[model samples]
Target: MCKLYQFVPIFCISLSVVCAKECSIVVLEDSNEFIKIADCSRRGLSQVPQTLPRDITVLNLRRNNFQIISNFSFKRYRFLQKVTLSENKLQKIEDQAFFGLSRLNNLNMSDNTLDLLTVYTPEMFLPIENLTVLDIQRNIQEHNNDVYRYPDVAFGVFKKIVYLALDLAPIPELGQGFQNLQNLKSLIFDRCFLKFLRGDTFENFTSNLEELRLTRCLHYFLHVDDNALSPFPKIAKINFEGSCMHLKQALSMLSSYSGKTLDIINLRGLNCPRFNSDEYPFVLTVTKDMMRYLKTVCVETLDLSDNGIVDFEENSLLSFDRPECIKHLYFKGNRFAFTKGRQIDELNTFFNKSIALKTFDYSFIPVRYWLEENAVHHNEQNYHSSNNIIYLPRSLEKLILSNLLCNDIRRHFMNRRGSNLTYLDVSYSYSNNVVIFESNASFTTETLVLDGHFHAALYQIEIVNFIHVKTLLWRSANLLYAMYPLDNMFYKRFITWFRKLKKLEHLDMSSNLLWILPDDLFLELDRLSELRLSKNLFQSVPTQIIFCSTIKTLDLRNNLLSTVDYATRVWADLMSTNHGFSLYIEGNAFECKCDNLNFIKWIQETKVDLDSRSYKCTLLNGTVITVLEAYETMHDLFSNCRNSIWLTVSSTLLGTSIIGVVLLIIYSKRWNIAVFFYRKFRKMVEKNMVKVTLMMFSFHMAGTAYLGLHNV
Candidate 1:
């Protein structure tokens, strides 16, 4: 009996080894010693893979053809912490399918055919005591008339689940099944057909809930009871984007958290009612009722973009008495035009109230009224005393003013109280002249972006005043010699200032029609890390100006460069040193020939990061192809072309040589050959004449003899 038992044990051990090898299960590298991972995903699996490693912590069987999960399917995998059965044909899971996976923390069964939770009783999840995340999203049938009904005791066993995603699932109500999830922190209900949010909707998750996302709930409406959202004491983020809700309802829901600290409140793209008519001169304003609710929430960042707000009354923001607490405000993609009349006062009042405002984004706001007629003639005194003064808050730091039309920027920065500005962007503005900074300007912004065409002569003097700037962007300024005759002075002054900018770290001069750069222009920029010289007229990379070791991002796109002599050396050096860098040579006109064979090879073999997909090279026949594709077929193409050229040259030379030999022989014996042919022709003509004369003489004698015989 003892010998039989030993043989049985040995047979089982060998069978397990054979199963492990036959199943093609892969052990993941770089895993914990005690917890290994086995990946058997997309192996045409119809059932649970058995005989796996005993200590496997994670098993992935995603995108398989498994139909059902019977009881004790994962009983042997007691140490599993994660299992993914997503994108499968799973229809049902028995009561004890995951009975022994005690350490399972994450379970993903999304995009399956599981419609009903009747079989998934509380006992099914009793063994997974530490499961923190459960995703059963998008598992319901779309066209069925029967809705997925959650049992009253479905999730009662998962006491430690912290995050749950029920996206695209049809649940009629939050029943007693949710009361068991006492440790849930974040819950997502995206497109879940949720209609009303009552005060007791989140009653079960009151103590531990922190983040709630209710995005794209098309038919949703907030029904705030007196104690709505009062259970969530630690709620930090509430994303209600793309939901169909009234502005007042959204505001009232936020008012529930008046005394609590909320970090982010995103109400983007809400269906707010327009205050004015939708006619030719349309005007939409934010009413006081909306602002009343806005003032209730104490949030750090507020995004009100894409809300179709055209105007704000002078007292629109008076209800938000706590504007000092808000820091970052975004009002992009709105029709908030700031004219020279009452709107200026409204803007000043708004800024003066928001005391602690730091970053303000007012981009894409068209300026309908500019003091152009007055600005051209006004002196310093008149300009300062005019009604065009735009008062900025003292706490303002970063400002974006792109796509605005204003003639003078000095009014915004003239004698302002705050000099702590760090970033300023005035790109794509309609101002014909640059924003000139006089000597009296006190601000020293760190980053300045001026990406638009301007009067080049005006910028020549204005650029010298930004001595303390670290990052500068001057794209598409039309500073070519043809456009601006004073380019010489601008270049000289620019070089002078460039040498003094010791702290400059980023410089972008794209689309500036730059043909040549001074050799030591960028030598003094020791801290420069990113340089953009794209959309220019440079035939080759300037090694002297771009060989700094600290540089990491070099954008030379859309240029007149045809070769990479210096660029190759620089990239090779950077690669050898193991420095991180990205080279963008996409739009250059690279030559495709034997002369560039070495460069093409380097492009293929170098370890430097390059966007070779868009990097094009022009072939000898003017055919353009991607550098990567050309690299594979360049040798054959060149060989064929070389052979064709040699063949044509040989054929032409042979034909010319044959013709030349024939002409030379004819020219050497020209007289002799001509005389011999002439003599032969004369002898043939003499023989013909003699034969004719003999015949005529014989005829005449015969005639005389016949005449004498007739006379006798």
Candidate 2:
């Protein structure tokens, strides 16, 4: 009995110690980046560790209310990098705010009320000499003029720093040589260049950085000299993804610069080919020497998307050298062709020998070459080499052949040679009038793109498991397959085939014959985000469309919508406020009655983007107006109708008097009543008044016939 009692007491103590809640501790071992702490709350604990572990990067102190950080407050951890102080109430950072730790990098101070930063000193960053990456996004009061005087002393602070992201930085003053950041690898000046960043403003790291990503800049094409990019010995990547370029002279100079090491260049949104022919020279861009440099090894990953280049230069593809270096080309939105047979032989020879190439994406290129001979020669080779797209060769990995393009159909008819092709997208083109899979099908594509248009009467496109395709692409196709005279089994087969796709990420079924979708069809989505079901036969909004929570973009434009009200509520139920999505609802005729009241209300409040150009007020009565101007027009027209009604009421009273006068004047026999009544005063004058009124009314009615008022 004594031993049992002693053992029970000891067991109770051990259990209590193991389950006891300890004090909240968030320690930063060596100032690394990224830290995750769950249930970081203990009763009334106010302060916690400001930094985290050495290897753990990108800390999220989100939703935590912190007031301030003293000097060396986060200097304990040297390896700590990328700290996120977002969604917090941080007021200020004392002098030497992030000094001490040597390797500390990437500080995210977004969404805070911080207004100032003390004049920087050496001690603040002495601990971390190789510090790089800093982001103070969404901070309201980052502009502290007292510290933005382009102090030469601050220039040497980041001598070895790289990857500087100061988008929407609150610094008021900006200029070249503001700081001598000699070792920057990437510089992101998003929107911050709107007011700052002159021609020479990027001199600090222009000579050193390899990647320069500028988005939302008012002047995307800021000008600079050869010395601007020449400073960086190993420059490669460049991205101008958003907005148009600012200067054309500088861009042309850079593209043709001989002393440049730029390998990965993205001229997206630059619209290079559309460069006002009058102001910019397009013909002389890729000179013989420039083409040789491109082929040899100067640059890679060429992007001409959104350039609107429609002119076909026979030597356009031949300008770049052999496949030993250049690969992965993108010529989307251009009108290059082979009309002149001057360089067709060279292009074919280059395509066959270039073995170091990979991906090739060509959206729209006109056909001017010897159609029959060009297609036959290339088709015979089954061009699948890495560098050239002239033939479908066995070495090809990813090939995108737009069906609408003017290419030989026989080349892909059998496509038995496309065994090595992992990704193949064939949207029909003008020249590819006929396309069908040959029976001796041994090659299996991992990705297959179906024609997005009704050029051919392919009613159903569901592949069997015989092909190794994991993704099925539908490009902007709108064919009422159920009513299609060609294929009645398309709808049924498509539904069954879609369920079998286990690794499909992108599915485009926009502009089809879908009236409403069954709920079960959406359950097949694993992580689908982009859906294009616009311009369908749907009369009412489909609620099942919202079941896919992973969907980020839902395009229902050019659809059969009568009102915006129901769609608004449907969005509210489907989309969480914090997780908003983009909804495309253009070209929809909203019934301009009580039904539209809800739609208008929702459009004015929701954060989603609607196609503003297509928002025309469509009414049941054959009248149309812009949605923005609908209410005003209705008020004006209703007022005019009201005025017309009042005029009719007054005219009726006048007509009665005129009719009586006409009876007295025309015959004069009915004047006895008027004469008798007026005899007591002035009967003669009253008799003439009736005669005059009768004549005027008769003239008015006779004129009405000519005025086109049929009833009048």
Candidate 3:
């Protein structure tokens, strides 16, 4: 029956192969009359495969060895609307290379050896005149002189192009190369070197422009004229990531978008110039005067991560007229001067003014605790000691405070109006002297992350008050017996706290080195759908996880499990009958022997989703093979075990028969053996009596003979 079942999968695979296209390239998507995507990337092919269907609409030919794009190379695929020829050795493009691809809208030819001035010509782009998006970034620029100019005639025909990404060859101003892109709405310049921008830099390319990205454009110094971006008034999104600019230049750029509402503004890693570092390190303070520059701008998301912002002035956000319009603020990796009581006061004042702020990321900031000279004591022992409470904005939904050095978290962000956050992350932010949940604190966040902390602090806290939380991540919390003095006391407390979260749907306790869990640990988590226990010390599948029938995913990767025993396999099969449960047991050391023969059979027969390709099992002869290979040759691998079972049963019966025959012979001669012992005893007594009578007669005759001799 098992052999019959194996043929079902093989037959299904054959049918699938017959239905697919017969080509070397992989077909990703197919429609009724056309293959939507055909990927031939990284195949090491010298030329494009001609066996592909002619109705292919998308072709990916990246990382190939094609040196020249021959004319009409893609003429067969006339319906192709997008083509990727990046990371190739294309030094030349034939005049009519894209001859029949008039409907092509996107072309990516980045990371090639195509010289801009030589390979780009009017005839090269004449065929695909309707191309809307062109990405030719990171290509070779063969500029022999300082006065070399881009071949504008080739790009002048892309009148319908909306997006263009290319390397900006050191030019003083935005030349007429992009003037012909009248319908352009977005532009990306990589490896840019614009030290200064004049008022008329983007002269003719300003009307329809709305987004610009100047990535990796590092320079010693940068200067933007006040009116440099004045022509483009409708620009909404600007990304200057990895740009080395002083704080003043960044502020000047932000000031330019004073009255406009920007959708995204990314200035990550905005730092000072390399030269004159001793004079100006670019440490900034967001003071009231700086806030005045952004009073009117309503930015939806502002990312100033990795900027050295040290201080904030009092009432700084009050200087902004539309402070409530800012929704997201990211200040990761900033060293704030929060050691003083007055700094906390100023931060609260700033938060109070931004009533509409929805998300804030204050991760990786260093903090310390201090008490006021005359502090007021509260009844609940909340960390805030002063008379005033530091409340966050009521509208805040997400907050990330990971990896901070604060001693107490309750001292900050205690909203009086009862905050209801959607997500909160406080991972790795606990100090050695950090106090646990000793107050009557209640949280309503749906997702909470508390990784890398001791559970002893929260042992006696009111965990039932966390009513709305659904996802909890407490990874690497060191839930081991050796770390605590009592046996299983800490595990009990950990289970107690988790059981209170009745609404939790996902839990991750990976990297905790847990070998065992109480049988009732997951008994109350009725809503748990996914549980991660990877990177631990479990030697077998934890049977404690059988309590939750709602679990759909159980991650046991990178553990000490040797094999899935018959009992575990049976339980898993039964559990997966109702829900589609997936078990991730990769990176485990599995053994291949008769002891695990049933497990190997279950791997092939069970409906549970076990990632089979990654299963590596060790054989009895010290050889390693995959589980699938062991299943294919199981009769040979377990032949000795089958023979040994028969030998053991036959030897036991033969030994028992020999003992039974010896006992029967001894019982049949019991009366005769007893009579022979009685006769031998009677003859020994008669012989001793005859010897005593003869000795008495000899003594009497000697006495009579002595008397007769005396008379004579």
Candidate with top lDDT is 3
lDDT of each: 0.70, 0.54, 0.72
Clashing pairs in 3: none
lDDT of 3 at 476: 87
Superpose all Cα atoms of candidate 3 onto the true structure and report the RMSD in Å to 1 decimal.
Answer: 10.2
lDDT of 2 by residue, 605-639 (tens): 65665556337766657677666665545565345
Question: Candidate 2 local accuracy as lDDT?
Answer: 0.54
Clashing pairs in 1: none
User: How high a TM-score does candidate 1 get?
Assistant: 0.67
lDDT of 1 by residue, 1-712 (tens): 0111110111223332322223333445554444466767776666777667667787888887878888898988888889999999988888789888878999998888776455467677677757899887766555322344565476766778899876533235456777888888888766455555677666665467888887765543433344566777788888877665544466667666765567778776555343222321223477675566567666778877656676666656434556777788887766655555677667677678888888888777664547666665455454444566666676778888777654543334332633566788878877432333334656567898878754442355645666678998888886564233545645566667778788889999899898776667788888888889899998888766545777878889989888788565556457446677778888888988877777777788776777674478898889988777778887677787578778989999999999999999999999998999889988999999999999999999999999999999
Instruction: Select the stronger candidate by TM-score from 2 and 3.
Output: 3
Tell me how many clashing residue pairs each candidate has.
0, 47, 0
Model 3, residue 149: displacement in angstroms? 4.1
Cα displacement (Å) at residue 615, model 2: 26
Query: Rank by TM-score, descending?
Result: 3, 1, 2
